[model samples]
Target: MATFATSEQLLVIIDPAARQTDGESVRIAKDVLSAGAATKVCLPDGPEEFARALGRRGSRRPVVIGDDRALVRAVTVLHRARELAGCALSVVPVGDTALAESLGVPRGAVAAARAVLDGSERRLDLLVDDSDGVVLGGLGIPPEPVRAAAPEPVTAAAGRTWYRSLVRTLAPGRPRLPAVPSPGPSRLRVEVDGAAVVDLGQPVEAVSVAPGTGGLARVEVRPLSVGAEATPVRACGQTVTVIGADFRYRADAAVSGPVRRRTWRVAEGAWGLTLPTGS
Candidate 1:
């Protein structure tokens, strides 16, 4: 791992969409860091520029100024560059609440910036998809309806309020689709560490497996049913596989693939990230 000096220079990548929301606010963050005399800021206009900026991140730490998606983009770029293991990431969230709150980043851009200025870095586990892309949070099956809804530019607070209202409204109703009959499982085969765990043709709603510390894999299988509770599938192993009908899956807040099957492996302590203190 690369060691950074206490007075190391820093690069700031501000998502273009976020710049439109409040460019001045982003400027404020930049000015704050400049005044601190402990960092330097680089604002990128798009993903291409973002990648270029990160390619040159060097020993200077990176601070992302945008939403969860922005954070994901930064991590993806660093991971692709094979620098994630050594780089510490910071985020000033300007978008959706689900991901940021779950990751323990503050909502206000200024507060998040402050945290970045004073925060300690720690190693965190990241989920890697079949494509070898890293996801900073948990993955989920059956993409949530809200995810597909078109996003409108709204303040962070307003967006959170709207999302909470929508969740409350949808929580009480049965899913729009008919529930798969009991024991009416779909054909899915699962394996862990090259061992056949579940190989059957039955009704299966979703299957999730989490790689734990020390090469352990936690596996959980849920049957397709109306109002089935979503729970963690715990496992500790290096590898996991799932085969089933084509379905959409979400990694972090980004959606990917409608593949017939997919596989994931744990790359332990793959990235350094900053989370809220005491979290």
Candidate 2:
């Protein structure tokens, strides 16, 4: 674990979303941070400028003042540039903070900004996909159920509403596998560290994977059943792969995919986060 030095120089990148969503919070964070340390602030207008700001960050510590998406975007940029290991990341929660709080950062502008100035840096695990994307929280297959709840007559509209509800329940928290979706199943092949956990012959209600201890990932697959609830098959491994008909997944707070196959490998302690001392 790397230790952060007090009074370290900072490169503060305030995401546009943060500014738009909660200008007051953003202002408070800025005021507190600038008052304590030598800080350089960058206000990027869009994704391209955001990436550019991070790419050019030299020796200063990068502190993101934004929501969960902004935090993810910062990490993604640093990871892709191969510079993630060199610096500790800091975030001041603005707008959505589920992912930040889950990772142990203090909530609110004053508290989080204080963390930026006085916190310690701790290494954390993350998932890196074959496509170079990263997952800081849980990943859920299908994101939501595609089937209607049993006991209720199935209808296209009902299925949509039910699925949306299912997705909402899997809110971000400490990185862990998400719960199986309610009742609907899709055919998929799931493998962990090269061993098959489930195959295409069996339909699955849902699949989830998240970073786990010892540089591995926790995987769970809920197989479809007829008259009874199917027990979720679970596994832990350094790598997880999923394949089948075009499938979508929710990683952290973002929903992505429709791809036939995707593989994720655990990168243990791949990044550092600034948190309260002794956290």
Candidate 3:
């Protein structure tokens, strides 16, 4: 919850995808940043250069000008490097903004840049998996469709696609869990903390794990149903474990795993992001 003074020195990294996707917004973000502070801009073509730029970011605060995917990349990169604790990150969301908006980042380039220069820093909670994957908001299963009307077919490739559709941005070379065979809905043995909430006896329709109130992770489980109304069970805890046949789950924007199981623990206030003053 540290408050940096106005016109703070900043390392503004613009993701290539952002640059290609929305040059106008990028321009607006650059102009605003250029007009506001002592800024060093890094235009990295890919993840390596992006990582290298951040690794050498000296005393300047890191400001990302991109979409949610870019923000996720920056967070994951910094978290893996163990430098997230001291970093107060900012973003000028330039593309699809669902994730950024969910995290309280304003929706447009001008306002977002203004936020970077004038807003306050917020230490936020994140979820980290055993594979060291980090989620800024949350992850869910029965991988929700990017478009609800586009019913995705169940197949091995589709399982990977399902995971990827929800997956934000993953650093290149990161190990991806095996894709599950997708001929049917997975029956996951889900547990919140140590209590079993969903068992293998029932087919699971969906599952969502998110940071909940009281610094705990919230877990929701929906059992499959044909005729009756399905009741979803909910619980809160610091950790959630899912065990069953090889299954896949969406984390942030990325889908991962066909591993027998995976566990996620809440990392309370492990990182910070800049938002408007009143937010």
lDDT of 1 by residue, 27-104 (tens): 777776566546656667678998998888777778888767778888888888888877899877764546766667
Q: What C-alpha RMSD separates each model from the true structure?
A: 7.3, 9.6, 8.5
- Per-model TM-score, in order, reads 0.75, 0.85, 0.86
Compared with the true structure, the alpha-carbon lDDT of candidate 1 equals: 0.66
**In order, how many clashes per candidate?**
17, 0, 7
Candidate 3 on 64-167: residue-level lDDT in tens? 98877789999999999999999999999875667899999998889999989889999898989998889888887755545322443546764654544333
List the candidate 3 regions with Cα displacement exceeding 4 Å: 148-184
Best by lDDT: 2
Q: Which stretches of candidate 2 lie over 4 Å from their true place?
A: 145-183
Which scores higher on TM-score, 1 or 3? 3
lDDT of 2 by residue, 128-157 (tens): 999999999889987853333243233587
The lowest-lDDT stretch of 10 consecutive residues in candidate 3 is 168-177
Full ranking by TM-score:
3, 2, 1
Instruction: Supply the TM-score for candidate 1.
Output: 0.75
Q: Cα lDDT of all candidates, in order?
A: 0.66, 0.85, 0.82
